[model samples]
Target: MSNQKTSDILISEVGPRDRLQSVSTTMPTAHKKQWIRDLAAAGLREIEVGSFVSHKLLPQMADTGEIVAFARTLPGVFVTALAPNLHGAQDAFQAGVQKITIPVSVSEPHSLANVNKTHAQMFEQVRQIIACRNAHYPAVLVEAGLSTVFGCTIQGVVEEDDVLRMAHTMAELGVDEVGLADTVGYATPLQVHRLFTRLKHDLGELAGSAHFHNTRGQGLANVLTALDAGVTTFDASLGGIGGCPYAPGASGNIVTEDLVYLLESMGLRTGVSIEKLLVARETLKQGLPNEPLYGFIPDAGVGKNFHYAGEKA
Candidate 1:
């Protein structure tokens, strides 16, 4: 019932950041800029351009700051980037990202492995980032993206209570939003429904996007479940490319093109133009010529009778 009408859903494209960071080949900065422009033209309002981590850690994201600066010039686009800690957050803020997402893995082993910091240490870092934002960049939104909430490849079976506790703590820490991530792609539809239902109940307006991976091929199903649970936003990669480099065997986020087609077909108003999205996909391919792109809609095409949500029928 919550998602019955033509609801406006946000599909936050993370290909420029998440997918690129996972690959060995670095996309040229010019090509990256063009890809982002094409994506924005497709009506993707929010885009995670890149991460503000060290060049040594992720050279693929070395051009994040430049990308952020370029993306900010585009009207009506909410530019975002990932920041691992206070230092990265500072860099991201300085680069003029309207929003920044900090990964906070729920599993202890994952927390240690991903960022080399325990939950307590990460919380401290988050606190510092919040103080920095409040003092200087008060307009920038800081989002805590809770990773590996469904299950972890490193630790396996993250507890729901732990996930809720982390979200509650993030809300208390003055974070703008807290989102749940299926980092290793082990979630089923029922699990997604139950967990997101609880997440929205606990965090209310602070409950943010759903980041699902198609690693186990359940991504779209999980999205439907989350939609029913009142999630209005999702994080997706352009070609179903991307994985947690730290979380082994975790590959393929939900494809943005397919996600748009799915949402539009369901009478959900995502504001993305599928025709333009396909063109953007071509640009992504041009940037990363060797990479494989995945999407059923891209391959099969929309049928003759299909109409986008809210279209005159």
Candidate 2:
């Protein structure tokens, strides 16, 4: 179940890919490299470095291959990238990403609008991508992410049964892991707990990271519920800088700095150094000055008396 060997809670940094893709301003490649290095040095063991999609569609991800290459050189870092379809998965494989996440929306309309493929078509693409990985890069892991599992902006109130069915199908298809994503920030803590609990029961070791948005300010609450449901891995942005491009009204992922603060304060070990994380986030700010960066911990600073879990006071 572990992707890396260091932490009790694995905070997978998604700012480079997820945040950069959503924003209009593109971060320079060298800044991205430094930011990722700083993140790794700060004790983040896993990072979603970039996406392997068409540059025409998302020019922000144009340098993903380079970013993946750079991220691979950092010791102890597991580099991941998002691949929308079989073609993008192949590109990711060729680029040598340690893991590839392919998002499939349980909401049919969302699936179509996001990737221009229906859920059934996406299923086929996943099969093809897995086959390609098996034939060429067996060591690389493919994760099936159930985006919009809670609800969809395009078509609201996504069915829970449909999500379970798709997760079951993904497990059957041999994906390394299956995860739920609150793509449009439509999840409540109760819904997150219930759905994640069900996903764990259905997928067992395959139920993976929780990707939540703070659009409605329910992201941390959902994380608490997911942890109660036995999920450890989480996807977060450095400065709370991302949202789904196709899912309207989806604003940003939960801020990584704030999430780490909460986790460490609760005695759950995340291994990220809050001080260094803030420094790394400054790199992000410098890279994309026009884009807004959000985090509670950064503004308020760590408590003078607070110490991370296991640190001697």
lDDT of 1 at 95: 91
Model 2 Cα lDDT, one tens digit per residue, 1-313: 3354556799999989889999888888998899999999989989999999889989999999999999999998999999989889988999999999999889999999999998779989999999999999999988998899989999998889989999999988889999899999989999999999999988888999999999999999999999999999999999997998999999889999999999998888888999999889888889998888898899999888888988887
- In order, what lDDT does every prediction score? 0.91, 0.91
C-alpha RMSD between model 1 and the true structure: 2.5
Per-residue lDDT of model 1, residues 1-313, tens digit only:
0121334898899999889989999999999999999998998889999999889978999889999999999878889999989999999999999999999999989989889999899999999999999999999999999999999998988889989999999999999999999999999999999999999888888999999999999999999999999999999999899998899999999999899888888888988888898999999898889989998889998889788888976
Q: Which parts of model 2 have CA positions greater than 4 angstroms off?
A: 1-4
Clashes of 1: 0
* TM-score against native, each model: 0.97, 0.98
Residue-pair clashes per prediction, in order, are 0, 0
Clashing pairs in 1: none
